[model samples]
Target: MTVRNRDFYKGIIKKMLTERLTKYEEDGYKYSLQYNSCTNSYCLYYTCPGEKHWDGCAAVEASEV
Candidate 1:
């Protein structure tokens, strides 16, 4: 989805920080968010909790405005 509103993303970041939700589990998978200092952005990571390896893992980076 495309979001033009910067406040929307900021709100999500704020909520995540307020809740201390750097990592969480949902639908049997673990999701995490990490900030990249060099890029000045956040990346959403997902991986299967049952997996022994890093297979099927991926990250989605939020574009900076």
Candidate 2:
């Protein structure tokens, strides 16, 4: 994956997170958005350089925090 692809995925994730965060805020839920990122090392069949993906993205839940 080229820089363009990496950026594209990042943008997508950002948008998704932003939308979700906005919803949470609108619902009067206070929380922090936290995400765990990891690379796809096991799926080597379609590996691309500089390509990264995000997983385990979740909110910290203000109540829990």
Task: Return the top candidate by TM-score.
Answer: 1
Q: What is the lDDT of residue 50 in candidate 1?
A: 79
Which pairs clash in the backbone of model 2? 1-48, 1-49
In model 2, how large is the Cα lDDT of residue 48?
35
Q: What shift in Å separates residue 17 of candidate 2 from its native position after superposition?
A: 0.8
Model 2, span 1-65: residue lDDT tens: 22234343344435546576422221222223344335311111122323343222332222222
lDDT of 1 by residue, 1-65 (tens): 12225464454555566788987665566556688778767765555657644333233344532
lDDT of each: 0.55, 0.32
Q: Which parts of model 2 are misplaced by more than 4 Å?
A: 1-4, 21-34, 37-65
Top candidate by lDDT: 1
**CA displacement after TM-score superposition, residue 36 of candidate 2 (Å):** 2.1
